[model samples]
Target: MIDFTKRQKEIMTILSKHEPITAEQIAEMLGVSKGTLRSDLAVLVMTGQIEAKPKVGYYLSKNMQKQKQQDIWNQTFVKDIQGVAITVKGTTTVNDAVISLFLEDVGTLIVVNEHNELEGIVSRKDLLKVTLGNAQATSMPVQLVMTKQPKIYTIEAEKTVFEAAQMMVYYEVDSLPVVKPVENSQALKVIGRITKTNIVKALIEMGSEA
Candidate 1:
């Protein structure tokens, strides 16, 4: 789960044999500088793997079971990686999409219909290809340039972040629209997004929690 470094694992091993250990003792045993230990210890403490008592010492938390840590790492819910999804209506002009792209500072825009149901996706490259030199390109509807349904890739909130990442790599895209499938309808409602950057943010948060 929290892919600990070899030195960090050794630090844990040392703590396992001793109920509580001093920071100095850990650094000496691991042959690492206090500065290095500080970072490792911070991650350990942040992840709840170890507890530090001021003026006392560091001790492994009783609740830090291996299985518990594994369970936390196994979480795949897309909501765990959810972030704001920038969108534009299919009827919006390419010019407007460009403006939104610049205004929002996002690489792609989710295109939706009147009901806010997913219709397609537009990327910077998509806009560039059609609008780069054409004077009338700006007036064209975004839907005309978007990668529409049956071609665009999407992820569900219930899916795992790993799967989301996999889809991005497979599709050679930087992001995926997070959607909710209607029980009886053919449409999906766009809710959020999970991007490569979102994955990095999630990992950072996980490290912080760790």
Candidate 2:
């Protein structure tokens, strides 16, 4: 089962009762800063639990509300959304990894060891700092520059898509590594990835049907 923090639950309750409300209103009611409210709102939005309107404010979308209810009732993980993950070896050169990111049109890549265990993650932003400084990508190894042992987030293959969506939102990341249970120490293998683009595509498809 997916777990939410007390603060997140409180935020959800507030939005449910008085949605289409501004971040300011939420902050004032919760006795918190606008920044904190915004962060909480971002998590809800990313999880598809709530939506923000430009001038109108924030509201719990109909789909999300229904989904939440369904989750509480049946508590099933819907596997409708899916995507493939691209990975690179930790020993790969920075230049090669950069090329892979471009070719895949993805913002992140999971770095693995020879045993197919997740070693680290490299993101476009991580490479950007070095790339902009005129450093030779060829000379730099991905291991030297990549984010080591990043907080790896994952969802069960059978879990609801929203679970993965929520994790991405909570962590403020673009993608999540899909994994399967493995042995000790390296207990998960990178199997796939989920991104904001994938979530948007699913939403668009749902909208098109309506």
Candidate 3:
């Protein structure tokens, strides 16, 4: 099951009690910047925990009630977070990574070595900086262009989805790599990736239609 952070829980509680509220109101109540509140709101909305109305503010979606009944959050696990996981060899060129990103329609790519062990992670932002002025993408190795030893987040297959959600909220990350324990950090194996998009989809599937 996914986990919810204290802040996320508090925010959800606030929305539960006073939804259809403005981002300004949330910011004031939470003593956070509007930008931070907006980020939280984006995650919430993406997870189907809240809904936004143009010029009307945000509200707790009707799905909340159904979520309670089905225990939707409790049913989520690492396996539920599966998606297309494209891997690139560390020796691959930066240009190849860019092409993969476009072709795969993915923002991030997991870089692996010859042994299929994760070496690093590359995101659009990482590539943009180098591509901004450079003409050669093929010359740059992915290892030199990727975010090495990134802060890794994981959840066990048997854990509750709420726990996973909480971790994401606490870390302010869009996704978490579900992994199986290995002898060392370099040995970890990615089983799946839990993302905000998947969480929202799960909520919609379990929540009320309206």
Q: What is the lDDT of residue 164 in candidate 2?
A: 70
lDDT of 1 by residue, 131-203 (tens): 8779899999999999999787999988887788778888898899999987799899999988899887776
By lDDT, is 2 or 3 better? 2
Q: 1-210, model 3: which lDDT tens digit per residue?
A: 556667677787787667678888888999988888767778788888888898988887788755654465776665765564577988888888889999987778888667666667788888888888788765798888887754555566666678877888998877766666667554766656667887888777655432
TM-score per candidate, chains pooled: 0.67, 0.60, 0.61
Of 1 and 3, the candidate ranking higher by TM-score: 1
Per-residue lDDT of 22 in model 2: 89
Q: How does candidate 2 score on lDDT? A: 0.75
| lDDT-better candidate, 1 vs 2 | 1
lDDT of 2 at 136: 70
TM-score of 2: 0.60
TM-score of model 1 relative to the true fold? 0.67
> Which regions of candidate 1 fall more than 4 Å away from where they truly are?
1-73
lDDT of each: 0.86, 0.75, 0.74
Worst 10 residues of 1 by lDDT: 64-73
